[model samples]
Target: MPLARSLRLARLHPPQVLALGFIVIIAIGAFLLNLPIAFHGARDLPFLDALFMSTSATCVTGLSVISPGEDFTLFGQLVILTLVQLGGLGFMTMATLVALVAKRRITFKERLILQEAMNHGSVEGIVRLIRRVLLYSLVIEAVGALLLSVRFLLEMPADQAIYFGLFHSISIFNNAGFDLFGMFPGRPGSLIGYVDDPFVNVVTMVLIFLGGIGFIVIDDLLHFRERRKLTLHSKVVLSVSLFLIVFGGLVILVFEYTNPLTLQKLSFPEKMLSSLFQSVSMRSAGVTTLDVGGMRQATQFFSILMMFIGAAPGSSGGGIKVTTFAILVGAVIAMLRGKEDIVLFKRRLARDRVNKAITFTLFSFFFIILGAMILSVTESYDFLGILFEATSAYATAGLSTGLTPQLTGFGKALLMAMMFVGRLGPVTLAFALTPKHEKELVRYPEGKITIG
Candidate 1:
């Protein structure tokens, strides 16, 4: 096929366009990172390492084969930050924003791509929603940076503090989990030095929550003040998110309360704070105030579950999404109770939505397991560690248990693939790879199978 024909065919599917856009962005990012000016050390970065970092940053997965703060120069860090921002908003949204600024007319195909990217129900008000999202992100990130910079200025030089504040604010808001704390004196661990600092902890957690919650939810809430009503999706997202944060925090507190390597050394108040941060971070943000590698096995397992569930849909964070998980649980309960509908908030979920949720959850689990199995064979790590790393990458949660840096080349490649899939999602990847099927004129009989 000619290049023009191939491009036209690609434009036929929104998912394919989105996936290809990400691949192109990742490739460009990798090439930029491979440049000598991007690094501070004498040796140039290996191609695989650059590719892995590019994938992680562009996927918003913080898993790094090397310490970014110590290894990458200012230019490199800026490049990573750019990738994070682009990845967080998604390429389609960014492109749309550019088109809006350039006064270019957005085609119907572009609108479809934006709708799919934003997970919107209709093409109507999509451009408006994009504008809202962009404005909202900017305002939130600016405020977060200002607040954090104030606190950071007390400890470091003005310029350094400003940069640190901006970097972290963007990283947390994007749920990217990349950090520059490695360069701080006596504070090598990410956010560990701020464990006891209420200002830092609260601000970081707030940003994480705001970002992890979908843009649709934010828009709903913003409009709710006037409408006095919230959409079912927004209601479910907020309720489930609050429950997960509180419940996950309590679980972490109980599991690691006596673990000397984690929270035992901290005061009661500090422990509570650490627990809350850990719980929130595990869901989507990968920044940690404690040693993830030293946590108890139970705590690690709990974190793995949280990571696998991840943040809400249409958000920067990846995974099956909280709504999907909730729908699955609701569906199971409905089935057991012999109910015809999977209902929540006095509303019944559409059959197609439930099916999509089930499909997403199952596919997510399959990929995580497959990645873990691959790692187990290629590396000598324990099963739990492999599983933890795999789930982290597969969910784009980035909360690693120190297994990422030690992974062999094959293992790294496997994880890079996981991060890419996790970010794009299995469904989107499927849509990108498979051609659309035509509906059959003949109907087939359905066969019932016996099950428990």
Candidate 2:
């Protein structure tokens, strides 16, 4: 039956299936959520709001107009969580898990779909990689939940503590950023209320870091001793990830250290913790320890850059991806040095990979700019806030400068489109939209063009 299903699905390309799967899931989620049983007493969720939240959650982007904890009943929250899990680990992955559990073979066409969904290089070992992905996700989220639950017991009842711990662990580990803290009246919500809590801060940051690094990197690290070395991909991801976190934290610390609305009230240690947390969160985790709205405009602009770079490939988090940014930087350096190839860690990158990175980044930039421009006209927010919201959606970074909730219906729709594209990736969406072409049979003569 699974093979037959794959055969029927052959009408659509793998990328199309991957893209369409999200839309179908989002539609079902929105319908379920708009039902009366999904919300708190007598509250009606408009279809648009439901659709927006559904898109956000399904994309693993946490730009919510409605507070998940306050507006959503247990049923609704559960629906959102389900969407996050499906979105965080691509639906194809969940399908693969189902096949594995059912003892059904994953047909080659299905493996091809999984390969595209997971951004894997090939169909070989795709099943094994997915198995490892599921294992790592479960183990990591469990440990994070355990730690958080223990900490929550210090402040809340056992039942509530456990639930909050579980929900937050899954959310943060998936980089979805939804939080139940909003249920506490007058609380600033997110991780802001726990700003000085080192345990929560560290655990949340760890989850975000792990989730942001691609599953391939996690698998590589797990077998490092046996392998005796890391792959070039893993090395680039790790080094770039470390540098971004450290550099972004320092920049935030310096910029906001004396701002009265932000870090001024915090002690040195607390400030450092807040800065570090924001740095990690900017890589698509979205939960913040500081008041993102209160930070200096300069800091916010820098944050846009961080969010734009976002997490590594094959990770739950989004953006153009760290590797894409790295490739562009490497390409620039190579051009400056008059080198023929882009080299890193004693390995040369393929020209096609570099070209794809460039094209991907440009598409992302154009998409965000277009979204921001339309938002500026449709909403009353300032340019910076508009840009931040647009970038946040496009990168699925979920960090907002207080502009999300005020967005008009049209603005929400635009952002939903952005989140959808951002999560699937512009390149993937393009492939899904256009029919595949065969390899070029005719060679064209090279035309001389002026260099930049």
Candidate 3:
């Protein structure tokens, strides 16, 4: 009873409650992984590295300094996967589901927390929604695993291929990209080392794409079948995502098709496929068919942009999100229209939603800037690479220009903070932390500022 009271008090102080949950989860993961049996290949690691690994896993970002295969045993890998799953589905979601499994009645407070955790509305049957979320996740993952497993069988023996398929499927769907085929069977530049293998790329891309589009959209499509007319959110996500993928592919194909370092050697069709795959892969899914390190500056910059937009909301992938960008665009259009409002699909826009879009944008940009600035002071890397790292961390996109492992202690910590903030989100953390404003009785006269 004392513990419960203490926890409720902690919840009232929101920042600590959120931070504490993250810390506890990381601590548990590190402790389990720091066990003597955790090492796979007789290489003992520093405790800090284990903690970092745990944070990365829980964040579902693939910016790891160590190879999972050589560094950790099966037990540790399983633990990491569990954390990834828990993190991908918000920790609160997992707790709520577990509570339901135990047949425990949810406190009203728990229901509210669950709603907040998932960015969901105050539905009457929120617990049932959580169950639906879990069941839908399992079904999607299972189908993906089955499809991926089929693609893997011809290349690898039955047992090895099945495990590979399962691991990649979960990782991809979670947008975690923690590949066991690192360096292709632990050799550098290889995951089974055949980067050009047709089957692998296709299956991986499909898994990554499935996981990148937010689950809310999926749920909406499934539940509200008659509303095939589409919400602004769904329309924006679909259209923007498609456009970015295609446009990014065209850019990559044009830029890299002549570069000796990347897709120049491939046949034209292969190059196109690779470009298309890479474009889709960039929107917060980290699977890559081509080596990131050797790309041209132009290609690299464009890749950063895609990563910045990321997958849509309520999906596994993270970024400012497509809908946010769309809303921002719509806000601009509204201003140009001089209609005094932003409307989409002939529907009125909520000011709070627009403000949230802008806040998320500003928050993400400023957060990355702060991170890059810190990395500049602490690390020896040049400007562009550091910015890429910072943006990747903030977006939780996990693409790198190869500086992740070389990061200084401070750089790693900064990236870890970025990942955590990226996952919990800036507005959400701010909302949770800030004291609620009481209604003001008075308003000051408006003052005009200079126009652009």
Q: What's the C-alpha lDDT at position 314 in model 3?
A: 73
Residues 241-333, model 2: lDDT tens digits: 999999999999999999999999999999999999999999799899888899999999999999999999999899999999889999999
Residue 408's lDDT in candidate 2? 90
lDDT of 3 by residue, 311-389 (tens): 8877767889988888888899988988778877787889998988998998888888888888989989878888888
Instruction: List candidate 3 segments past 4 Å from native.
Output: 1-6, 9-19, 41-43, 183-195, 224-228, 435-437
* Candidate order, TM-score descending: 2, 1, 3
| lDDT, each prediction | 0.90, 0.92, 0.77
Comparing 1 and 3 on lDDT, the stronger one: 1
Q: Pick the candidate with the highest TM-score.
A: 2
| CA-RMSD of model 1 | 2.1
RMSD (CA, Å), each prediction: 2.1, 1.3, 2.5
Residues 1-452, candidate 1, lDDT per residue (tens digit)?
12213545755588888788888889999999999999878899998999999999999999999888888999999999999999999887887777778788777777788898888899999989999999999999999999999999998999999999999999899999999877655665678878889999999999999999989999999999899999999998999999999999999999999999989999999999999999888988989999999999999999889998999998999888999988988988998999999999999989999989988989999889988988899999999999999999989998888899998999999999999999998988888888876889999899999997
Q: What would the TM-scores of all predictions be? A: 0.97, 0.98, 0.92
Runs in model 2 lying further than 4 Å from the true structure: 1-7
Candidate 1: segments with Cα more than 4 A from true spot: 1-10
Please give the TM-score that candidate 3 achieves against the real structure.
0.92
